[model samples]
Target: MPDDSAPRPSEEAVEEAILTVASLPGAAKTVTPEDVARSVAAGPDWQSLLPSVRRGALRLAQAGRLVLYRKGKPVDPSDLRGVYRLGLPPEG
Candidate 1:
């Protein structure tokens, strides 16, 4: 069973998310906590996540695994807001 109380994400998970997102096209950019949350929530053994998970998730996105775009420039998760989506692999 997975521990639900743990808030911090292991570097491996961050790297995995980054690699998964990186497989898509475009320059790397910011990803939202909600996005990460949703991803984490999908695991069968996973329960709820803490707010701190956002930090690791953002790190993964900003680290170049995912392409982030905003205001005509690449931005960090902290600079993102409103509705956003990942643009890679041409999701239709």
Candidate 2:
């Protein structure tokens, strides 16, 4: 049985959403924060998942598994604001 009482996002859920969406269509594709929020959210109140998504993104960025971008440029996860996108790091 699942704990339906707790509707909040979990770190594992958020991380999975980020990685899953980011890798869905190769490294060139990017997903918005809202995209991840929607993926982990259990209900229509996905807006509430933004904070958790951002936090997960920061952690993934630090671990080098993801990259956060704003205005087409990579931005420090700590400095992200306004609109942002997530994607796998560029291949070398």
Candidate 3:
């Protein structure tokens, strides 16, 4: 059984993960909790994120940082879904 006593992953981590995934073509389509977990596994200070951060990440994505998409449809920031797209090539 899972340890209920253990602290749950922070929303910030999840949101950051979401953004990271959003940056990627496959993950941007469907953001899920599991995908976020995979992001944590990759490498992040997951222990320090807060729920607000998660919410903030979503807000950022919606605003135009991460970029959201669905059903092969591109997310236009001005839409009701507040969906966006990571259009530009990632900078090194």
Candidate 4:
């Protein structure tokens, strides 16, 4: 089981991991939920944090620092479901 009193990963940490991974050269600068989750997980429990990664992705996307993609097209973060990828928005 999990410890309810245990401190969870910070929202900032999650967002940072998303940005960091997506900013990498490969994968077209995009990342999956599991990517960020594993980066933020304390050990090997990354699977449990998938939802948190998604939520952080939404927050960062809303803040305009990140972009959420579905089916290779940029998407509105608020209406995400199924599978999605995250990346830094194109610089202009």
The lDDT leader among the candidates is 2
Q: Which tens-of-lDDT digit does each residue in 1-90 have in candidate 4?
A: 655565788877887888888887766667788877877776667888887888888888899999999999999988888899888889
Arrange candidates by lDDT, descending: 2, 4, 1, 3
Q: How many backbone clashes does candidate 1 have?
A: 5
| lDDT tens digits by residue: candidate 3, 2-87 | 34455666656566666666557654445543445545643444333433434544576576665445444555544524332333
Q: Which residue runs does candidate 3 get wrong by more than 4 Å? A: 22-33, 41-57, 76-92
The candidate that wins on TM-score is 4
For candidate 4, the lDDT comes to: 0.83
lDDT (10s digit) by residue, model 1, range 17-62? 5445445355345444345555555564332443444454456556
Tens-place lDDT digits, model 2, residues 1-92:
34557657678888998999888865456889888887777666778778888889999999989999999989987798888999899899
What TM value does model 3 have?
0.44
lDDT per prediction? 0.50, 0.84, 0.49, 0.83
Q: What is the lDDT of residue 70 in candidate 1?
A: 55
- Scored by Cα lDDT, where does model 1 land? 0.50
Please, what is the TM-score per model?
0.37, 0.82, 0.44, 0.83
Model 4 alpha-carbon miss at residue 59, Å: 0.6
The C-alpha local distance difference test score for the whole of candidate 3 amounts to 0.49
Higher-scoring candidate on TM-score, 3 or 4: 4
Residue pairs with backbone overlap in model 2: none
